[model samples]
Structures are given as structure tokens and as C-alpha cells.
Target chain A: MSGVRVILDQDKCVGSGQCVMTAPEVFDQRDEDGIAVLLTTAPDTGQTDVVREAAALCPALAITVRE
Target chain B: MTSDTVPAFPMARAAGCPFDPPPELHRLQDEAPLSRVRLWDGSTPWLVTRYAEQRSLLADPRLSADVTRPGYPFPAPGRPTGAQKLGFILMDDPEHARLRRMVTAPFAIKRVEALRPAVQKIVDDLIDDLLAGPKPVDLVEAFALPVPSLVICALLGVPYADHDLFQGHSRNLISRSVPADQRGASFRALHDYLDRLLAQKTADPGDDLLSQLVTRVQAGELERSDAAGIGVLLLVAGHETTANMIALGTLALLEHPDQLALLRDGDDPKLVAGAVEELLRYLNITHTGRRRVALDDIEIAGVTIRAGDGLILANDIGNRDPGTFTDPGTLDLTRDARRHVAFGFGVHQCLGQPLARLELQVVYSTLYRRIPTLRRAAALADIPFKHDGAVYGVYELPVTW
Candidate 1:
């Protein structure tokens, strides 16, 4: 089985909340500036679809996922 | 013209006045075929007001979105000064095309279509919160802002906990008159914050948009900086603009009860799409688009625009053009509003458009269906309209069901 890890291009983050909304299990946001901080260092396999979905939904194109 | 002062561009004057821009331009379309006018920033630009002309100019290769042109009027300071700019919407062909390409895949139909159900769920949840609120509520605060902002949050992999801070900065940055220096700092703040967040994403990857960019960068498809810049651009453009539209569009519906009634009566996506189009045309939240500078001499609308001139495509004005839209002042959602320039045409059209459309489609349809009796709490005239914003939105749109 592959391990899991969450990646974010914070530089490209425009503070849109797509990731946090879809996968709160994997994403935690900084409300002070609307920036998303990945919650789990390496999320479980079950969180992959939500993580990918959040990444795809981001308007800033700021998130990435890996195993 | 007065001794030291030149006449302001008709489009701008119209923006300042509560009148239709096309009619205002029509008064001068012939007399002053082309006029050089000053922007609020003291920079002179060629204001393209006519409908056909504005459309032609946007697609024209001679004009560029690059703010690097010598004497190019950077609307507010702290802008990516001279080639250091990360905001891709301000660039020309190859660069604009390349950077745009990076973020395009996420918004494609195939990609965005999958997000529909999730977006619907968010809308329903938000509506539940709205229903639980005090009798009188400002829809802008209660529903309009959070719905899309949260959706955008979910898509970008940003933690929802941080929305308020970003929302605050976004609100101020979009204002017509925040100081240049302050705007610059805020932008840097956005960048620094994003950088920190991106670093985290890079170390421990997540399957979000940021992670996708990281893969491209690590895979040698894109540079680390390009990925970062795109993230910031998407972050701001994704939610802020839509938030404005949702708020203003709702106000537009409330102002015209008949249109509101029409929307409330149905939940069809196609019908809702039409309503969104009409709302974009009618409200044109971004009253005037970010200015585009002319790269060379170009002729538009039978008027010759000199080289090195700046063009501010006033979309709000184009939407109300009598020549194009019949009964421009009316809010007939059924009007053939697809041709409107609210989204701007050609290469620089909004990159997040599909997502925006999805959000609007979901929000507008769900809103009226859930709050069927939703009505403006105050008279139309009593509601404060945002006239001073770069993207003209209302201060509050109080409603009661």
C-alpha cells in the first residue's frame, strides 16, 4: 500500500476556501488570512478523493497530493 | 477643455453618475469619436465605451494586458512593478497563455462538473444556517459570501478556518480608494502567507490544487515561483469576484421583484444559467475591468486609438448598451444576455468562469427555492449601493423570508 501526503502551493493560493470545505479531514485553514494549512502530515487512503477533489476545485490551482 | 484639466472619460463620468454608460457614451460617440481622459490615478487612458468596439479591442492582439508599458497607468501602486508581476491577467500572449494554462485544467467542464454535488451540499448547509439566523439578515453576510468562498476553499485545499482574514483583506483591496502602499503590503502579506502554506504542502503533499502544481513543478512542468504565483492569483480571483457577483446579483433580483419571482419559481440549471448571464450583464459587479494598455495604434468602432494609449473596458457600460441589448434598463432574465461583455471576451476571459457559473447556478437556484418568500427588508432606495468599489457591490442586502 502507498503512503499518503498532502501538498499545497501556498504561493498560488488566492485564499479561496475550496480545499478546506471539501476535505476538512485533510485541510485546516488559517482564518486570519484565509490561507489553508494541511492538517494531517500524511492523510490516510480514504482521504485521497476528498484531497484530490479539493485540489481540483481550487481556483488558484494551489494544491497537490502524493503517496 | 479647461486650461489645465482635460474632460474625464465619459465612461468614468457615467460610473460616477447613476446613469447608463452607453447612453452617456452615445452623447459623445460622434462628437468626440475618441477622447484621451485621465484615470483616478492621474494616468491618461483611452476609454473604449461602445459595445462592438470594446469587444473588438479585447480580442485585438495590438492591445495587451501588460502593465509594463512605459507610462502605463498602474491603477494602484504596490502592483507587480515591471516584470516582477505574478498576476497573469496583466500579461500578453505567450505568458498569459502559459500561466493561464496552469490553472485551466481545474476549471474545465470535466473537472468542474464533478464539483456540482459538493457545491449543492454547501449551498444547502449554508441555507440551513441562514434559516436559523435572526428574522432579518443580510444575505450578503449570511449566505452570498460564505457559499462561494467556502467552495473555493474546498477546491484550493485551504483550511476553511482562515477565510475571515482573507475575506477582510480582499474586501479592502477591491475598494476603489485604498492607499497604494497599504494595498502593496496586503498583497505581500498574501504572498508570504501563501508561501508558508505552500512550503507545508510541498513537504507533505496533499491531493489539492496546490499539490497538483507542486507535482508539475517537481516534474519540471512548471517553476516553483510560477506555481506560487498561480496559487495567489487563483486564491483572490476565485472567491472574491464571485462573492461580489452573488451579493450584487441578489440585490439586482430583489430590486426587480418580477425577476426574483421568475428565479424563485424554478431550479433548472439551464434556466439558472440564463439568469446568471442576465445577472452578470445587468449587475456587472466589476463596474469597470482592470485596465488594459494598448500595445500599438488600433482602430475600433470607427475611431482610431493611438499607440501607447490605455483602455479601460467598462463592462457595466457595455452591458447596458441600447444598440446591443434591447430595453437595456430592464431586468428581463429571459433576454438573450449571452453576448454580454460581463465576463469579457477572447483570450483573457475569466479563467475561473466554469466554477463561477457552477457556484451561481447552485446558489441562485437553491436560494430562492429554500427561501421562497425572501424579500428585501428595506426599500430599494434605502439600501446602500457600493458605488466606490473597483467591483461595485452593495454594502448590505438585508432580507426576510
Candidate 2:
């Protein structure tokens, strides 16, 4: 669980911004459309739990986290 | 389930406990998380009462938000079911996403955060008006309704002077007991009003949302009718939902003095933010469940839902689900209640949530603190609760300082 990778499916994203709210360090929404943009594909150990929570909270199921 | 066994949809909340969801909803969640409930039309839609199931099903592509769909459960009889009437909220994605995205930038978290100072100013000015005005003022009129209405008016480019036209019609639109023709008339009134306003914005574009919508229309990215519809949605929802939350949240806080003390005495922004989420969770203003229809067969909790089956995600009780929140009945401001689905769960979840949150955070943080002696001017029983409306709140909250 040391190295965590996050993938956001832009196609499935509905721009709910739950991921951005939940894990600001790992996700940021594009200014133009509010679609989520991954700040880091690989989140550090401290950010892993919140990244997982963001993935769980994403309404569109657009965020995927692999550890 | 047999008709005799099926409980009617939109069950009434217990007497004297206006803040709680219908007791039957809690029982259903405890006993059968997914069960059938009879609607006004004698149609039984599956009522998903549990939090996890609701979030899962709401996110499922198999469910469609199109109001015109055959099995879609209308809140009441005689209500119009036009998907265009409320804009993209009643439509599913590709289309929902397309129309919703056009206006998304304005309500994005960052954009809404920028609105905090303006909202705070509005709250402060309203509280000033309340303090200066006669004692025992109707908070709904003197404070609650005006806050969101003024903010939305500025944001949507709708004139605050025309508040009566929009507010009156919106009142008719959300009341479940309103006659169908009256409701239809109200819908048209707001629709036509917004249409005319959009036309005005087309001629003299302003630095607001409707004007931005006009820009999309000129670029051929959005239809004029659709732009009007989006205006109607934003106008009605932006004001009605948040206004009710302010009044209702204030009432809830007044009843719980300790909670009020925590909010009124605390200087921490995090404490205020948590209180807002807890209030949103505890007092789910949208009590009439989120209505939807199944687009494809789905199986959940050992129940097989047919493609045409209608579904109601009762997020009020879902927020109260014991599995999700411990001691769900209590209103603890300190509780980590952010996970609650008061605004709902899924792509079609509240688009105005950021704005709503910002407004509530400002009000909850500032109001009680500013007016430390704020109390109910009328007895709780004398207060008119909006039990018949699609949104739950007080019609008028009389308050004194």
C-alpha cells in the first residue's frame, strides 16, 4: 500500500467535484468545465486514505485508485 | 407486494417532531431497505431507504432521471412532467451533462468560494435589517428568504423587484397539494418570465449567469428554450431550497440551545462548516424522495428491478440510516456528517450544493453570533410547517431578539 496510483476517467466524470473536495491534494477541477484533473497520479502515503475516500465518494464512479 | 401491504409514498412526519423524517421511513430502512410504496397514482415504485443502496443505485447508469419516462414517479397527481421545464436536472447524461456543463463553471467550488464575501455581506445586511425592524419579525421574510433570493437574483441576473412573480409561482410549483392546472399555470408563468428575461439579456448582456447563458445561445452551443429552462431551474432552486434551509436550520438550532451556543459562541470556521453539513444532514429539506425510473434490469439486495420500474431514493432517511450515521436521530454539530446524502448522491446530485454550502456556512456562522438573544417569537405549534410542499421547511418563522 506504499505506492498508490490514481486514475480518473474523464469520459465518465460528471464534474460533481466530490474528489476535489475530499482530496484536494490529489485532485483539482479544471477551471473551464469543472471536470476533475488529477493533481498527482501517485499520491503519497499521507494522502492515500483520503484519495480512497474520494474514489468511494465520486458520484460518477470516475475515479479509480490502485495500490 | 400487495396493495394492502404497501405503505403510501411521502409518509407524514411524526406529530411535534418536524425535523425528523417520517417514522415509517426509518422503519422501512431498518426492516426492508428496498421495498415498494404506493404513489398517488396507485403505482408502486421501489423506495430505496438505505444509504449505501441509494448511492449505488443513484450512480448506476441503469436508472434514468427523465421525468417523461413511463415508470417515472411523479411526486403527485396532475403535476406536469416536462423534462425541459426544470432544465437538465430531470434528464440523464450526455444531454444532462451537456446542458449542466454549460453552467458548471459558475457553481464550481472555487467560483462559489469567491461568492462567500458577497453572501456574508448579504447576511450581515439582512441581520441589520432584522435588528432595526420591529420586534417579532417573520424571519422567513425579514431574513431567510431574502438572503438566498437576493444572492440568486444578483447571480442569475433576475431583477429582485420581480421577486413576487417568481416567488409566488415557485410556491405553487413545489407544493404537492396544489391543483394540476394551477401548478401548470405557475410553471408557465416562471418559464415565460425567464424566457422574456433571457431575451432582455440577449439585447444587453450583463456580467451574470443568464447573460453567460445568452452567450452560449449565440454561439449555438445552447438552445434559447433550454437557456430559459436553465434560468427557471436556477431561479427556483437557487432561492427556494436554500431559503427553506436557512429558516429550517435556524429553527432547528433554536430548539437545540446547546447546538446554537456552539455555533453562536465559536470562532472556528471549521466548526461552522461542520455545523452546516450536520444541519444539511439532519434537516433534509427535500423530503419528497428523489424520483427516478429504471432504464435496464437491475438486481440489488436480492430484489430484481425491471427495466420500467420506478424508484424513489429517500435520501432523508438514507441520511438517517444507522449504518451510515451513529445515533442518527440526534443533531450533533460536531459529528462528521459530511458523508450524509442530504444533497443526494450521484451525477444528478445538487448542482447548487457549493453555493448552498457557502450560503449556509455564512449564515450559520454569522447569524447566531450576531444576534445572541435570537429566539422564537411564536410557539412551535403555532408555526406553519411546509408539510405539503415538495421541500420541507417553515412557511414563516417568527423570531425576536
Candidate 3:
């Protein structure tokens, strides 16, 4: 089993909301600005794939998911 | 390809096929993913055709969106004469980020989600009026245009009474065939109108995005001119893109009876939203490629784009690239089209997408379910498409139930 930690660099976020779209459970965009706000540092195992996908797919690459 | 051999960019779509993208674009995709295409001003920009390459390049920081940059390719002819350079869409990072951040909150997914009930109510009311009205009505004017126009107006605190004034100018602004002077006049008219609206918001702030921006302006967090500029960008983009999608998407469904049946019979929100995505990918309303100037040397798909070289990210073709989407040409509503770049890709991706998506979902699901017998009043050939417009759509979609 692999353990993962997700980190978001707020400054780099372009607010495309791809991360939230990909993993809404683990991420939500701040209403103040569309930047990603991590809802859970370590999401459940079932949602890992989507979290990884969100990190990979973020156009700004602001999201980092380390396994 | 060099400037001498490169053909002119912005090729027109084939006759009788309004929904399909320019066939020449696909040919280039199959041949070379990245090759130079000459623009109107004799500048040869690398036209990226493949999906993966486009996705990667759009996110690359080296490509500059600043129109003032020396080698930047202006998609349209002449400068936006009277319009001030406003909003972050045309800017590069830091500055782009600073300006865009101010307007992002109101359009965030959660914030937009909160407006679903209102959006649904608006859609239902519009459909009710549409149903009560006479048959063989123009969908663009009657339904498609009003829904987004109303939603955006309500959001921006712009008076709905002046829709005709702004809408008229918006049409003139986006039409590619409109003469430069006329377009400039339209731009000036809208700019002045927005500036006036912002002043009103500043005086009597309402519970709207523009009003909130006024607070920011008062606090010195944002510039008054920039706020007005944001208003201009939003006023036009907020409604124009979605309005076209509604009209064109509806026409597309009517043409494809099977697809129409699928959308009509099903009330599932997920299914309807997915169908909207497929339609967006299939009929990319924004036909012109995204223009950018390379800030530094960059190599992609085996071609080296030198510093100051112009690049065109043709997302319309990219959405249909066979490598990414199986049977790219077909409009399969069942396809998982979440990856579609219809809203665009990278940092400069659409800001109003969440609201647009919610509005589209409500409209697509409600329009068909309410009027099961809805059908096209005129043949596809008889309907005039906005071929010479910045955004692709039918000028007037005549339909009857």
C-alpha cells in the first residue's frame, strides 16, 4: 500500500478548478479567489487515483501529490 | 515550414457543414503536429494541431498572451481602436494573476453552485414563456440568448433593460466580417456603457460582483480603470459564448435525431451535463486559434519555436484530435468529455466556466424535457450560420414544437 500527501502552492494556482473537478472530495476552490484549497491533506485510499489525476492534470501544476 | 511556404491562417469551414471544423486544420494535424502557418500580416506562427502538444504548450509559461509584444499575432485585423487594454486575458503572469484573482471568487464552482436554484428558476421561466409564445420562433432571440444574458446581467448588476444596447454592440464586436471602424465604434460604445455602470455600482453598491469590485476599488485594492476593464470583458464574454453554445448545440441536436432523442427522453443531470460537454467539443464555437508570442526558445513535437516567434493554439482542432478522442469527428454524448479544451486549457482557461456549465446543464436538461415535440422549423441549409463571426453559431435558429 502506498501513502500519499497532497500540497497546493496557492501562489501558482491559476484557478482553473481542474483539481476540484477531478477530486472535489479532497479539494475545494476558495470563494475569495478561485485558487485551490486542500480540504484533506490525506484523502481516503479509494480517492487516491483521482487526487493523483488532479495533481497531474492541473494546468498550473500548483497541486503536488507525493506518494 | 517557413513564411514563404506557409499558407494563410484562419481558414474557413467547408460549405454545408456548419458544425464541423475547418477540414484543412485536421489535415495539418495528421501531417505535422507543429508547423508554421502564415498570418494576414505575413507572420508565420507555429500552428499546434495535436491534442497532447496543445495541452502542454498552452500551460508553458514561455508563450506570452500580451498583444503588445512585438511578434504577437493579432487574430483579427487592426487594433481594438477605442477599447482600452483591460483584463488579465491579454496579460502574462503575476499581472495576469493579480487582475484575474479579483474576479475569480464570484465565479468559483461552489459560489456558482449556490446560484443553481436561481439559474434553474430562470431557465424554467424562460421555457414557460417560450412555450406560451407562438410556434416557429427564433430560438436565438427568444430562448438561447436571453438565458445567459439574464444570468450574466443579474450577476454583474447590469440593468436588463439595456440588453439590446449591449447585445447589439456585442454582435458587431464579434462578427469577423464587420468593418474595422464599425467594430471599433461598437467597442467604444460597450466600453463607455460599462464605465458608466461601474460608476453606478460605486455609488450604490448592490449584492453583485460589480458592486464587490467597487468595494475593492474604494479600498485601493484594484484600480477603477481596471475594474471597468473587467466589466467590459465579463459583459461580453459572460453571455456571448454560452448564448452561442445554446443556439448551436440545440441546432446540432435537432440535426442528429438520435442524439436529440437521447437528450429529450433523459432527465438525468449527469447525462445532460456530459452531453453538453460532447456538444462543446464537437462544435467549438470559438473557431479562431489562441494567439501567443513565444517569450523564449521552446521545442515541441520536434520543432523548435524560437524566441519572439508567434504561436497559435488551435483548440478547436485539438478537441477533435483522434489521438485523444476515439472517433473524434463523431458527436457521441456518452463519451467522457471532461478533458475537452472547449473552455480552453492552462492558466488562462475560462473564468466563467462553472456558471456557464451550470446554466448549460439546466438549459439542456430543461429545454428538451419541457417541449418533447420541439423540432427545427427550417431546414439546416436554409438557416444562416455565423461563419464570419468570432464565435460560431446560427444568427437565428428557427424552431417549432
Give the winner by lDDT.
Answer: 2
Each model's backbone clash number: 59, 0, 0
**Top candidate (DockQ):** 3
- lDDT per residue (tens digit) for residues A7-42 in model 3: 899988877777887789999988678788999898
Q: Model 2: per-residue lDDT, tens digit, B185-279?
A: 88888888998999899899999999999999999999888898999999999999999999999999999999999999988989888899999
lDDT of 1 by residue, B151-174 (tens): 887888777798877777777666
> Which structure is stronger by TM-score: 2 or 3?
2
Q: Each candidate's DockQ score against the native complex? A: 0.02, 0.67, 0.70
lDDT winner between candidates 2 and 3: 2
C-alpha positional error of residue A64 in candidate 2 after TM-score superposition, expressed in Å: 1.3
Per-model TM against the reference:
0.80, 0.98, 0.97
**Candidate 2 lDDT for residue B67:** 86
Overall lDDT per candidate, in order of appearance: 0.71, 0.90, 0.86
Lowest summed-lDDT stretch of 10 residues in model 1 chain B?
Answer: B13-22
Each candidate's B-chain TM-score, in sequence, is: 0.91, 0.98, 0.97
Q: Which 10 successive residues of model 2 chain B have the least lDDT summed? A: B76-85
Between prediction 1 and prediction 2, which has the larger TM-score? 2
Better structure of 1 and 2 per lDDT? 2
